[model samples]
Target chain A: MSGIVATIIAKYNYWIYICLMMIGLYAMITKRNLIKKIVGMNIFQTAIILFYVSIGAKRGGTIPIIEHAHGGQSHAVEAVHYINPLPHVLMLTAIVVAVATLGVALALAIRIYNRYRTLEEDEILSRIRGS
Target chain B: MKKLGLLLVILSGALLLYATVDFPLWGDPSSPASLHVSPRYIEKTMEETSVPNIVTAVLADYRGFDTMFETTVIFGAGVVCFLLLRVLGGEEGDHYYRHLPTGVTIHVKGAKGKSLSGEFERIDMLWTPYDLVIKTACRIMIPFIQIYALYVIAHGHHSPGGGFQGGVILGASVILLAISQNLRTALRRIGEKTVGILCAIGVFIYAGTGALCLALGRNFLDYAALASVLGTDPVTARSHGILIVETGVGIAVMATMIWIYNNVSSAGRYDEGL
Candidate 1:
């Protein structure tokens, strides 16, 4: 029981991320409104981004910015003193892609609304069946 | 259906939570992610690119190709929104125009190719009276927001912010303008043609720099090849190259965000919108 508690305490961030992702996924699957699904999708992306960024964190490390990188430093820079930058860099791209994806999805949603005059999935589906 | 969704969500969440046992402890410097190329990037970024922000160096210099494609992706999104939403030169229904002098609204039916004089301003079918406070506040804030965004982009080397965040802020100022006034007022400031061209131009600047490097007998996106052109040593050249690429990214992202907002808010009809 102590071991399990220790493990949970050590890795709680991942647990929270998983919970958030599940919430987002549940909303995406069950929400009838297109806008709600879009919001859910954004939540899912946010969870993943948070996960990646958390993976880059270090206990005693500062941000990825090098001190006196203009090169008048007396002390040599060590990797352990700074947080991992790779995930931050990758997540930056991911964020921009997320924004682009959201834009495209919202545009498509607008087009669908224009066609059916409704944003509810079942309503549009029934209208299609009637037509 | 909702029950099934909940069940599936719980199942996956539990599975993922179980998998967390294999992950490195939170904020562990010895994690596999930190053990690999991240160390090299952190150690060598200063020497190679002379940039304080290792993330910016890795993004613009080390991963230039990826960043280039990211810019292209944003531009493509803008183009896709345009193609999906923009409706051009169609027969719209009745036109509503408000005479400025008398505050009288005139409804013209089937007014195709009809031009109203300066005194009569076009209004949307669903028009709201302009609010003085919102308009004035936004107008005063817009220039400051724009200057801050420019600072974010230009001062990225020593700081946390860079092209993406700054570009979003810049694009948002225009969106704020659109919200405060109307779509037409915002569109008049930066025309549709200018936005479209600027979108392409930004991407072109990014790709053109890579092509320039290629022309100078180096591999694509190798900023060291820009040494002769930039009149700097290879290391400093890399730094300058990152800035140039960042500038391209800023422009592209700014244009794309504006383009997407313009399309979505107006639903492709270049008229009054919230």
Candidate 2:
């Protein structure tokens, strides 16, 4: 019990990310409106980005910017001194991709709305089924 | 159906939570993430690229090819939006304008651009109040915003921002203009044609740079090969190449975003866009 408690406490941030992910997942799965589903998808993406960024965090570390000498003397940078930059770089690209996807998705949604005059999934399905 | 969705969500969430047990603790210095090649990037970036910021170095120099494709992706999105929504040829009943100056009503034919002189202002179907506050504020701030965006792109080597963020900011300025003024006013500055050309040119610049390197007997997207052309050493040439590629990315992203906004907001009619 003590080991489990320690594990939970140590990895609490991941647990929070998991909770957020679940909320987003629930919304995406159950939301009827296409736009709502898109929002849920965005939320899910944000959760994943947050999780990746959190993995790079280090206790006593600064940002990824290097502090070097003006006189051209090179100093050894300790790995533990700075936060991991790879995740930040990857997430930057991910964030841009997410925005682009959202724009395209929203545009498609507008097109669908124009065609059917509705955004509800069930209405569209029924309309397709000729019921 | 809802129950099935709920069940699926629960299963996925549980599975993900279970997977979290193997992840490193928050702020663990010796975590796998910190032990890898990122430290080398941080330590060697200044010497290699002479960039003070590691993120910019990694993004522009270390991963230039990835950024090139990302820019292409944004351009593709713009093209997709334009293709989906653009309705060529105006509708006959689309024009019903009443001149505000003299109670004169003219039914404009689908004919393009033959409005009667400055004697008449075509009234809008969806009436909108001319917001002086927003207009004045945006007018005053647009120059500063554009200048800052350029600065951010140029200073990416030393700062927190790079091509993508700067491009978004630049695109936002155009969006702000469209919002504050009417879409017609905004379109005058950046027409649909201009956006298409700019977006294409942006991608071309990126790919062209890579191809240029290949021509110089180096691998594709290798900026270092342009050293002889730039009158600089290979390292400095790489630095300059990164900057140039980043510039291409910024321009591409900015044009694509504006194009997407114009298409989606107006639904390709190019009429009063949001």
User: Model 2: clashing residue pairs?
Assistant: none
Q: Please write out the lDDT profile of model 1 over residues B148-196, one tens digit for every residue.
A: 9989988788898888778889999999999999999999999899999
Each candidate's number of clashing pairs is: 0, 0
Docking class of 1: high
TM-score, first chain, each model: 0.91, 0.87
> Against the native chain B, what TM-score does each candidate's chain B reach?
0.97, 0.93
lDDT of 2 by residue, A1-131 (tens): 99988777778889888888888888888999999999998998998998989988888999888765354777776767878888888888888788888888999999999988899998998887985
| Top candidate by lDDT | 1
Model 1 spans with C-alpha error above 4 angstroms? A1-6
TM-scores of all predicted structures: 0.97, 0.93
Please estimate how well model 2 matches the true structure, expressed as its whole-model Cα lDDT.
0.83
What is candidate 2's CA lDDT for residue A24?
Answer: 86
